[model samples]
Target chain A: MNMMTGVSPWERLIRPDRVHGSLYTDPDIFEAELKNIWYRTWVYVGHESEVPNANDYVVKSIGPQSVIMTRDEQGKVNLLLNRCSHRGNQVCSFERGSARSFTCPFHSWTFANDGRLVGYAFPDGYEGQDKAQLALGRVTRVESYRGFVFGSFAADGPTLREHLGGAAETIDRLVRTSPEGEVEITAGFLKHRVKANWKFILENECDGYHPAFVHTSIFGVADSMIGKLYGGASTALTRDYGNGHTEIDLRPEFRKRDAPMSWFGTSEERLPDYTARMKAAYGDTAAREIMIDGTPHVMIFPNLFIAEIQMFVIQPLGVDDSVQHVTALQFKGAPDLNRRLRQQTMGSVGPAGFLLADDSEMYERCHRGVLARNPEWIFLGRGEKRQRQDELGFTVGHVTDEVPSRGIWTHYRNLMEPI
Target chain B: MLSRESSATLMSAITAFLYREARLQDEHQYEAWEKLWTDDGVYWVPANGADIDPERQMSIIYDNRSRIALRVRQLMTGKHFTQTPQSNLRRLISNIELMDEQPDDGDIAVASNSLIFESSLRDDTLWAARNEYRLRYVDGELRMASKKVILVNNDKAIYTLSFLV
Candidate 1:
């Protein structure tokens, strides 16, 4: 009776210590995740800035389902299935626009911005049927916090506030830096396709161990900048912000370290005065928060990541491929010249940017290696023994440690396995 | 003392200079291309066809001479990973037309149709766009005051664009 006794793959995942490589590459597991995690969880869509006016809408994806996020005449935001009730055709084909109603291309079925059934091609087709119930299907819940929007698929789960937990403070800080207490997405976005597992981006961004090696060339250029400015000492500081978040703080010391003295002759003198002008405009506290020493890169677990001057949304296209959308953000009342400067700096990190291009190449190479035969697990044991607990109950490590990456993978495993 | 024939000849010279600039970019002769700009020249790739200002709408690429030089420096460095397996690109420019000529301000407005072909190890990409250039003559040489590119598929989902278009 017990002849077939053995550990199942599912059972193996339930174990705490390790995960098999199949979790990264298996088609079955990918399908399961699409159904259970992505479809069932509260996923981020677009920010409120995207649709600031009534009738404005943006197309987004939740799991495999394409949805439309729009504001109605009453100013309530609706997340409804993009498909038409008649023939499953996409209702809103454009990336974004302001429209009072969407008409299915295949059939002339129209739905209001509120997702209500407005009109049909033929009035005689459904003489006495329940036409009112044939409206576009809506998401289980659509909630927003600090202008960021999120939607859940399940009928029952924690609220958006509960889901964000301690991470809400980070978003608050981001908005508080803006003088108007709000920020809007700048026009145009940078889109790039990476040939790596979607989880890899989440892991790499927080993993401080790889940068000094993976980005040696970038550091080399930056080193020259530091040497010329600060007499050969680098000024970058990397810290682990517990619960899988890591922040890279670049300060004035970082700029001086290894920088060329000649590099600052023109721009440096102008920057401080400009910042001083901003300080006068927004007050000292706001200016200090906006400046933030150097640039601060923060990663919100699973998919959302924010750089000081930009916001990125990483969407999983498949287990082996992901699409990244990068958008520059602007404070409501900043000067034109300063906005241009921010855009220029943000450009250095786009698909065409020096740093991002190199990073994507490395990701592709890693994907290729993992796909090869006899691939071993990539270890994250660096600084594991030296981990020190912080006051917030998070373990901290040296700047060049794998603690952050391990933190992300640990959460990944926790989510993949049932409690 | 200039006649109509001389005016036509000058127009031809301006058109040739513009064509030469495109050739330099296609050949990756960035140093020579950089010389084709005025001191305050601007390169703009708007995200939308109707965009009038880079200050408001998002642009795919916007660079002044200094930022453009920085981009070149970054590309030439050893750390530019995205280009490890460097991409090779070839662009075709055609349908050149003179939209306006303002000799007083040393400026001319021109329009052209272009097609960009780029190849990498992963895939080959084709970008077709309409272009407009506002050139200002500096010391008797045509230099760009502004250059704008409007792509056909700017709003669709796209693969990595690791090179200039």
Candidate 2:
């Protein structure tokens, strides 16, 4: 219990039906979240395809702290702190580049791409100093699952597999879309800046309820068949796969159509070459199911979001600001499909997207609305009574339910509350 | 090189066309702006930088003629929230230069700089960019064949840019 407020953290901030508004605006709570959540968990760093070649490095952030994900000489991906150990200067300043070694500008301290101290300008000055100790600080644990890299600051906690839990199947489904069983993130990212708390994005990404109201303009409910995928009458299900991961499973609805590639708004005739390749790779039945199922609309807790043809990684800048970096997923042997994916990504995502622009506006409006102080709690009680476990043991509800947000908050409360 | 008089006339015509296009955009004259583009128009606003390939790398806005019409239709819907209460916008076009005097497939290239001032429901934002245009004459009327906007800070995080750049 807090000595000043005389209230336990979970009771004061999070509850089953609602969460306190202070969780979105308070600086102290944001700091605590940085410690308890972002720093402790296995936060996604970068994709292995991003650094496909040796010496390639991309600078990314765990929370607010900058770190570099580099491909060493042996092609092993390494996550090292961007800071220089000598005088706390940033070693690499470029967003991404292929460099032989990172040479710090301040003291001319040079380190190899894999965080090995190669040499320094004034070596005699540190005659007795242990150069091994001064190498770049590395994250305690680094793991990769099918080219998706994640890093953890804490030495021990949940492994990436344990953290992903049942959500790993969603990732497997995405990779299987490629005929070669590989997905490449070669296309650059589109960073959409949102003026709201980072958690809003986590909850909103899997949210099927608001798409009907929020994106009515894009979907054009009167004539759009896609409009029926969400709202009260839709048969789609929202699943809370344990450990804070969740999915808006549209398979039931897609299966109702009984058409292959209907999820992508395409069909067998249009992509015959792709269909043939998929058949050759995974055989006819599995490829047919893969095309029908499409990609998963899911969030891997804390950061990663797999949105069908695109992937989004949310970066928290502060209590009331965040940036969502998104990229169009490229299939390994599907050139025809990759072209369509790029065009669709442009139409549906980024700052000028038809769908995302309205969502961005709502996120900002929600942040501004929370400043009103009267409603101390944000309602998340929708579908709580009807939610039940599916055959996969995941908590399931209607597509328009708050089961995902409730699951996220439940996991968050467990992390924040004293054990 | 062309004679000085011909150069002056070309400059004047291009400048007039740019100012008129800017007015159409600032006034939200959707139909008039739509008419200004050729049937095969391509509107591109590259993300990261202007050098990346649009086909391989992601861009902020990359639209062919059909997509351009769709964008206009979405804006005209009166429901796209980013522009429900349309952003009050005015932009300054300057440093107009004729990059190519020779017509390549009936199109001449021109370049200019833009400083757009936008006031929306949230806050005011100033956007700076270099705009490159491919202009062509269709039945004695100047039409835009292509337009590419390279934002000054395209490499960094950018806010909602729903309005035409």
Candidate 3:
């Protein structure tokens, strides 16, 4: 807490077992996080399927900055800052649409969907101003892995693949669920606003510890097997895949029951055509394994959450406010399954979800509780002594442990303190 | 089309039904509210836009008859923490109009505009929506065959909308 000392705040505040409460409430710390983490990392923009045709675009936010994901004439995805070069008015205002070019309403400066400044209203205003240089600002890098687009502001850093590390396989797992080996994010998102820090969502999404207590009501009313799935009785594991990524692996639990498609509460018999298609796509062995393994429950650092049946993007609005945009994951070739996915997504996520409503309340209460500042730290030491590294060198722990939280903090400290 | 006198009487009956339904929701009368629905009732609240395929697009709330029963059961459990203290709610219904065309099932189509005010956990939220309803008679009593709520801000980030819309 002493300012005279030369030690960085992260060094002083982030311990092995706990983190400072100010991480959730301090405005200065939040600002620092924006600079060190969000602005510098490969933040997910949107999936390629969102804009399938040329000139299609969707507006999204990376940290606090607005950006547009567009598909241009060549069917290539482009990420450009929404700011117009003329006077900084946001060029595209609509959430999603198709337009070959964006014209700034203030001065009528137009730019192509691929970030080219094409025209302006008046000719006498400027003679030698370089139109090429005046194009809409773009991220330093934009990369895609399995159609998931990510943009970064920092020009010099680890490549998106390097940043994804072991988490790339998690994304692959999500895409692999499709019979055609591709996923479509065409279903519109459900944005859930919460009165809490963004980190709470990052941690809670893959926490694996709060379900039995925080969601007992839902489990009780629905007779959900989630309690047994993550209640120290199942064989599920929580993993920290380094680089701020984490996962709650339920494959082991599903495999133990030998119930294929049980993760979705359905069986192969219920979806005969889907079953046939899966086998035809990947053969019997791989398809059976894929069905048993199911979709992933993973947090891909700084922003993206590939939850089992859906995808969530956590955008931080302020120190104590955030919005989670959620969408149901749809497969490329499975119509029957896609419908079920939509229904299940309605049942479990979003602002009015049966399960997430309670979670949002808890987040608000946690933010309010942390604001008290009576307790200087939030404990995260569960299973720290017993967590082990799997064959992939990723840290693994019990389903009821704080392995994911500790993982997030460890990588967070590394980034905030850069060395 | 019905005669003017019959239309007036039907309008009065429909108005009464809507008011009673609104009161039951505001009072948290879960049992009574559940009873207002026919055996095959459908409740839908579409997201992003009102004209969408619920089976293809994500919805805020889409419940078939069985799911409706499950939803009411969940609300009544008293353990659904989101509604633990329950929201203090009041809604005003206006601009009720009988739509043209009676369906083959003897259901009357009605449309109305509403504004709901909910005060909970020291936070206040105002919700505005246009509602469409299909009403039919079952056992000599009026019942809801289907209800669709289209919120004005369906495309924006929504806070906890745990209560019935």
Candidate 4:
């Protein structure tokens, strides 16, 4: 285990109570993380709804690498490296578009959206050069879980389902919230940058400890009753789903808010109609459970978070900066419900929203403070001992516990440490 | 389009109003800025396409008059920790032009560009936007009927935009 100190590097760096500051600031560690964590894990690309029609494509990135998620002529989704094989130029330029082929602007080395090299100028320039082999570098593995596409770069590892673990049921419940058992990415997305490390944003997503403090202004300034209801939610919990995923669930009363698409809570007026419809489809118990479950905030490790009808895709830019892409999801069959969802998303977590603004400021402050080098250890000792493994083998903790972040560190150490 | 002289005068008047509004924002005059809006005013900043409906699509900022006031109220309160030290701002407004007018409704539309210089603790940022404002003459005073801000960095990853720009 030891080269210099005769002890595992992670043993000293990542403890149950704390993680070293270098985990957030070291350039070499960031690179190592990209290779071991991001590259090795199953990474979400784009939802199938984003590329609904043939030839429609959207660009997605993991750290420094950009990839295209496209629906080819066959209507199957393909995840291909955006880099052109010939000159390493990005194959597709637009954010999302319907295109037959992605032509590299550098030398016009055109490849079909399916990762097939169909044509190139001066094909005989290098006679017998295998164009098929030279197609856009396809990711090692690509799979879709209910239209949510994900890709992995490593040649071998866990399958997408294996990678997801208990997070699968959470996702299943998420998409099933749609009356039609489907949802679409309708309202587009809001891309924001944070001045701190990428992990900070991910941790902040389910950090049940901060909302009461960080979003206090939101409660104070809100004119609507729903804000007050959220402000009044006294009980909360953060569940550690197996395989590094976390779910932060608030008390059932909070989900009792009388808003349409009330992921947090539902009211009596709309409950009858919603429950009636759901009962007709899945019976009373399932419908009631869904109603009571409210909105579940699920975080799929390395970087994907879905909560409150929105999805967050995080990209690490450097040791000190990260890009956060937020998309508002809409119910497929419920136009009115979709409208409400979009409005709620707009009011909450975008760049200027009541929540994200405070969080970003905190992130930057943390970044600044971490540079001090004197504090050495960042205390995560919040409710460490109270956390325990659940019946499903998950480590569960109360909302105020550092359980989620600890899970992240545990997973990070597992991935980064030598086998 | 109005006559050249009328358009010029309209531009000048609207320019002064906008500059005053910018100054109010920079000074963090929440109450005064709230007074600049018509009761039915809408403040919208589209996230994706400039023309997308803020009601049905994701927007950076979309506020009815009431919510706008509430937003300003929140920022004015010390609880909005992002502005604890209060972000320092200076805006440069240019290319003010009378783009459209609805005489019957007593409304006029103008277009302009903005470059907002913002500074906070240990950091500084420059924000650029194409601003379109619908001005309504109410009670013999021109008030903001609606403001649509098309941020230049809308498509990119941006940090906090808590303060008014």
Candidate 2 chain A, poorest ten consecutive residues by summed lDDT: A218-227
lDDT (C-alpha, whole model) for all candidates? 0.67, 0.91, 0.90, 0.80
TM-score for all predictions?
0.84, 0.97, 0.98, 0.94
Runs in model 4 lying further than 4 Å from the true structure: A223-233, A251-279, B1-9, B100-104
The Cα error of candidate 3 at residue A13, in Å, is 1.7
Which candidate order results from sorting by DockQ in descending order?
4, 3, 2, 1
lDDT of 3 at A123: 64
For residues A1-419, what per-residue lDDT tens digits would candidate 3 score against the true structure? Answer: 34699777787789999999889989998998999888888898899999999999999989878899999999989999999898899998899999999989999999999999999998678799888989899988999999999988898999999999999999888887899999999888998988889998899988888898888877887879878887877678999988999999998899987877998889999989899999999999999999999999999998999888899999998998899999999999998899899898988889889888988888888888888877799999999898999998999999889999999999999988854
Distance from true location, Cα of A364 in model 2, Å: 0.6
Over A286-399, each residue of candidate 2 has an lDDT whose tens digit, in order, gives 999999988889999999999998999999999988998988999999989998999899878999988889989998888888888988999999999999999978999999
lDDT of 1 by residue, A175-233 (tens): 65454667677555766678777767776665555665666665565443422221223
- Of candidate 3 chain A, the 10-residue stretch with the lowest lDDT total is A1-10
Model 3 residue A359 CA deviation in Å? 1.1
Q: What's the C-alpha lDDT at position B56 in model 1?
A: 58
Candidate 4 per-residue lDDT, tens place, B25-59, comes to: 99888889999999999999888767777776788
iRMSD (Å), candidate 4: 1.3
Ordered from best to worst lDDT, the candidate numbers read 2, 3, 4, 1
Off by over 4 Å in 3: A1-3
Worst 10 contiguous positions by lDDT, candidate 3 chain B: B99-108
